[model samples]
Target: MSSSTSSSEPTAAWARFLRLLLLFAAVPAAIAYAFIALVDPWGMLPLSLPLRRETVTTNQRFSYPMIAQDPRFDSVVVGTSTSRLLRPAQLDELFGARFANLSMNSGTAWEQAQLLALFTRRHPAPRVVMVGLDKEWCESGPLRRLTPRPFPEWMYGGNPWRGYGEILNPFAAEEAGKQALAMLRLARPRYGRDGYADFLPNDARYDAARAAQSLVPPPAAPAAADPAFEFPQHALLAERLAALPAVTRAVLFFVPYHVSLQPRPGTLDEQRMEACRAAITRIAKARPGTALADFMIPSPITREDTHYWDPQHYRIGIAERLARGLAAAAEGHPSAEGDYVLLVPPVGH
Candidate 1:
């Protein structure tokens, strides 16, 4: 009986230790997860504590979907980093609708299409749907149309419960703390509540020498045209635009690539790009309120090295100019400046 009692005591002690271990580990973990869930930095949780959530995270793939679904924004700016410079407030002023620039850095055609579909479904009678046309739209043949940054497809669903657990990670916790701190004005916001951010380097930090290096293109003789060249993603763009309500004015523009990066006038490169543009123009033509602003040509915007930060992204002043130009194009104003061609004019015009 004594031996049995002694053995049973050890078993009970071991069980107690196990319980303590679990308590120490589980309690803190649960608290951490609860903190993250309640703060809901991504705004993907139902338990979100109604924090005035400005974008606190740099991962736009995770942050911007909430902005896309925001009812305050009836219109959305969709594109890659090329479109990030377009300010939503300015766009709202220009287009007379609330705007959210939901452009993702290196955002693929697939991601853009998905997010756009999400926005059109969430909003009612969206005013102006502007898409910054990128080279990826002309991407031909067997493209998976994905980028290295993981788009949170899980967040776009109707059920918030499915995505709540995803925010329990350390990164999400850190962002949650930042989100809280942002509320207190202790942490700086990465993006505006309307999803606009000046992600480019400050004008004070402008390094022309370094900028020059990024502008230089590799040795390029015009490419030989393949009979198989196709703009597969144009169909995807059309489908997303189709999903928008008939009243939504769609503006599609080819983002200005640097002249060196743009195709030579008579080259096969030019042939392929123009072919893609023609198809895109046709898509825009079918939709009455849609307009196509063609900026992917060798003009002042593309040729002037001082105007651009790199081959793809332009300076802030230039971005604002483009915004105003887009507004003008939307109003059916002809490009008298010879900068861009308004391919498919707006409906009333």
Candidate 2:
């Protein structure tokens, strides 16, 4: 009896210790899970507790779907970081429609397609769908669907159940805490609700020396390309634009890159670029309520070093000018300021 008692006591003690260990582990895990579910850091959970949400993270691939699917916004601006500065409020006024800027930093063409898919899925007849074409659209190879930054494919638009597992992570828990702080007014929003953010490092002034440092000299002449060279990404773009309703005004503009980045005249680079532009122009012409603008040339905006924050990004004044140009381009009117040229004028022009 004594031997049995000793053995059984240890066994019971071991079981109790294991139970305590599990209890400690599960308690915190449960709390964290509840916190994430309630706060909905990504602002996607259907059961998310009532809270005023703002974009609290710079991971735009994850943060932008909120802007894409926002009910208040009936239109979306989809592109890479170059398009982020196109303020939604200005576009709203210019286009006479509610707008959301869903541009992502370093967003690949495929990623932009996914964003467009999400917006269109929610809004079948958006007033406008502005695609600020980037290099990815003209890139030669198969379109790279994503950038180096992590993109949550599940969060974009998919079976809702797929994301719960993905979002239940330590990173999401941390975001939840930050989101809670934002709700409490202790933290500030990183990007605006409509996904506008002046991400450039504010300068006291645009120093010519500083601008020159960021600008690279034009590239040396490149070897001739094979005649069969093609732009396959344009097809992807065509597919997306074709999905839009006829009533939806689709404005496709080559994002105005700095002159230094533009290809030299009549080189293989220009050959491929002009071909891509021609392809996009054809797609615009074939579709109603669609227009195309070419802003990739050596315009006053593109040639001025002071106008660009970098070869890929422009300052606020330039962004405004581009926005105005887009408004006119949508109506088949060429840029009055000569910042862009209309390739496919609007319908009825």
Model 2 — TM-score against the truth? 0.94
TM-score of each: 0.92, 0.94
Q: Where does model 2 exceed 4 Å of error?
A: 1-9, 218-221, 225-227
Q: What is the C-alpha lDDT of each candidate?
A: 0.84, 0.85
The sequence of per-residue lDDT tens digits that candidate 2 reaches over residues 203-284 is: 5576767776888956655647565467767777888888988889999999999988988776777877877888888999
Query: Given candidate 2, what's the lDDT at residue 105?
Result: 82
Q: lDDT value for candidate 2?
A: 0.85
Collision count of model 2: 0
